[model samples]
Target: MRLPDKTTKMEQAVAAIPDGAAVMLGGFGVPGTPFLLIQELVRQGKRDLTVIKNDANETGMGVDHLLVAGCVSRLITTHLGLNANAIKQMNDATIAVEFCAQGILAERIRAGGAGLRGILTDIGMDTELGAGKPRVTLDGQAWMVETALRADVALLHAAAADTFGNLRYAATARNFNPLMAMAADTVIVEAEQIVAPGALAPDDIHTPGPFVDHVVHIPELTQEYAVVRR
Candidate 1:
């Protein structure tokens, strides 16, 4: 059987996302954030988005764009220390923000991808994060049952990809790309470069083609792709 090419236009991929959808954005600040995808999402004016990300990236970038556009309704993330816009919006009741412990958040998404129901941990049992959460006692200790997280769509940035949609992320940029790729109903990638199927060896592929729905090739990296910090 011949493998079909999944390459597509960024606009079409992003436009498929409807209003009031849950979206998982892959990135650690600027490195792996799909800037073009986010821009398109903003341009298309998608609203009431519940964004699941590691952090609310600083103002003028990433999720901040969605926040500024009033596209986000709730933010599921680890922190908002860097993004004053997110903080302001959350504090002012413009958007609801749910905080999760770093490792626990990753585990929750991993569980979703694996088709598990949820995870139990003592990580935040005594904190506000654990408040009102379902708890179970295993052995002799109590643990919070954190539900798995799945998204309607996942936007990822890849260092490179093949026409088949096999993706490889660069260094730290790989942070949530691989995980989010598996946990979403539709996974769209903005690749710096898209090559022939065989161009990316199987060993180097971080996200296999079958898990990705669309691969959008970016002609050139913009100013947002530049390293803001090392």
Candidate 2:
């Protein structure tokens, strides 16, 4: 018995995402984001997408590219402070933006991966984000029901990956990559470095290969990420 190799071309992987799909992107700002995959997705011109991520990314990068290309219809995220374009789009009603508290967003995705329907919380119960959302009472206190978030496809970036698709992230880049991998129906990963199956030690593997669908190797990051890659 042998483990399957999930390595694939970047173009082919992004091509599988259909228009109007719910997609999860693994990243917190520039790190851990699949820039190449996002670039390919933009080139493919898939539209009407519902994107879930931690941030809107800055102008001319990551999620902003999708916004500029008019690819995304709705963005489920934490904040749009970093990207003026994202704020403008939200204000102009060009894109519908759903804001989630950072911790709540993570828990929602974790709940999805854990196969739970949703979780009850009081984090946003008194805020606008919790407004109009369903609620329940527990121990004489009200808790808002925040549903889990699962995606049709997940785009991830890893520092290194083995042939079997085991992945490892560097530093802060690990954010959201592992969780998103589990919550998505199809998980596609872009690795800066590719190694043999056993090259990555068990302890170093952040996201196991079984949860991953496709792995693409990119030898070098684009120059725009020169400072970021540092």
- Give RMSD (Å) of candidate 1 vs. truth: 1.2
Clashing pairs in 2: none
- What tens-digit string does per-residue lDDT give for candidate 1 at 105-206? 899998998899899998988989899999898899888899999999999999999999899999899998899998999999999999998899989888
Q: After the best TM-score superposition of candidate 2, give how far the Cα of residue 218 lies from its true spot, in angstroms.
A: 0.8
Local accuracy of candidate 2 as per-residue lDDT tens digits, 99-196:
99999999999899889989999997888999998999999988999999999999999999997899999999888989999999999999999998
Give residue 103's lDDT in candidate 1 (0 to 100).
90
Q: Which stretches of candidate 2 lie over 4 Å from their true place?
A: 228-230
| RMSD list, candidates in order | 1.2, 1.6
The numbered model that scores best in lDDT is 1
- Prediction 2 TM-score vs. true: 0.96
